[model samples]
Target: MTRILLIGAPIAVAVSVWFGGDGEPQRPKDDPSLRISRTAAAPDPLKAGTPEQQRELEERIDALPPGLADPAKKEIAARLVASAENSTLDWRSQYGVIEDIGDGNGYTAGIIGFCSGTNDMLQLVEHFTERHPGNPLARYLPALREVDGSDSHEGLGAPFEAAWAKAAQDPAFREAQDLMRDRIYFDPAVRLAKMDGLSTLGQFIYYDAMVLHGPGLGPQGFYGIREAAMAAADTAAEGGDEKAFLGAFLDAGRHVISRQKTEQTRDSSRIDTAQRVFLRQGNMDLQTPLEWRVYGETFRIDS
Candidate 1:
């Protein structure tokens, strides 16, 4: 799957309501058009260090408090991500959000923005079909697979978009999206950040990068960026200052963002005006009453 937005909260419970209008799923007129970056991959394995070093890192992480995983903080993360991804705080309203947005990724849809051009959208539909056979979007599996890795809508067009919208009306489908999102993005990002001995803010930084760059091992993917950052500075688990490591990570993320030619991917405001602002304030715990801008739009999560 390509660059998509996964609202960084446990959504299984939150998505159990109707998100469509009059039996149809429509994007709110006022919601700005969605613009996403690009690809999703399988979760990266713990291969950053030697077995002994990895074991030590695991132990160190096991001793830290639950940071981003905490329910309250997770809500904040969701809104923060929504501000950049959907341009609104009503993340639940995005259960049915779908469009190509002409970023060369086919049919970015659902709360996670699963792209038909990427592998994740196929997996999501497949997973949903497994749970509920003959679902509305099931017939398009072949087309999804055929179009994977590129922005070709070959066999899927209006029929496929309608099918996706129809499927979005199902709470089961919504729950499936949530489940796949956690499995593919959220859970792994948080787990890796914890292993890195990152605090709440650091964990969030990793998650945003993961959503934007995917979990691949490529030079621009989340793991590669982490590797590049670690090369510049040690992780907190490696006995380095948390702030320094996070700064290095943001620098690495900015570099990756800048290299992408797409207008969406090239924008680093998600890091520059959002996450980096928190870092500058030393809000390592990500305390509330937060304010930041992404894509030149300001958002806040006060509690």
Candidate 2:
């Protein structure tokens, strides 16, 4: 019986190996291509410092030198502010400045510049809003869409009317009434009629409205300037003036997009970052962290 059981076990083992065996499948054993080593290891728990130690570290950082702060930092910030405030400039020119200032700066410096610039722009906008309370263009011009039509009187008239109407009721309206009246001389219809010859001052005023209010204001302040430019280009094209319409079209399109892009980019990169960090951390100035770095660098405060 023992012999028979041993013989049966061998047969079972052979069948299992051929089908589903308990043992893992064996493959050709080649020399190991790589080797690894294990070293003695133990967990090193993270060290916890006392509250007093943290306070001491903070105090030491507060003693650093201010010269450690980057000079280009402030310059970048000032330029960002200036660009937003001066959005009346041609888009190409404004974009160039943005591109120059934004290139190759640390995130913190960029944040500083962007926040400063946006703050300046907001201040300027507030001033305009206060000064021209009723002017829709002054208040809401930034929200207009880009101008697109000939005889398009859509964006240009309403802001002026709103401003004038509000000013008329205010006691101080008489003081700057004449200037305001003069500024609003062209109603939307009139402005559309003379779109071709719109003065540079007109363009500036229109752009200023857009910048202060928002870019979406479209052509409310500018009237038919876009259309006339397009018209001139068409005429120039028909007259075989290759340089005329094509140049005008490209130039106008480029200027509009470039300026908007730059302003938006600057706003996003600088203003948005600064505001988030500043508001999140409370109203701390850029100088605080800067001072901390000075102490750490000179006296090894962190060390």
Model 2 lDDT per residue over 197-249, tens place: 22222222223222222222133112122333444443221222323432453
lDDT (tens digit, per residue) of candidate 1 on 117-164: 767888898899888888998889888889987888899988888888
Model 1, CA-based lDDT: 0.72
* Number of the top TM-score candidate: 1
Give the Cα lDDT of each candidate: 0.72, 0.26
| Residue 168 C-alpha lDDT in model 2 | 40
Instruction: Name the runs in model 1 displaced over 4 angstroms.
Output: 1-64
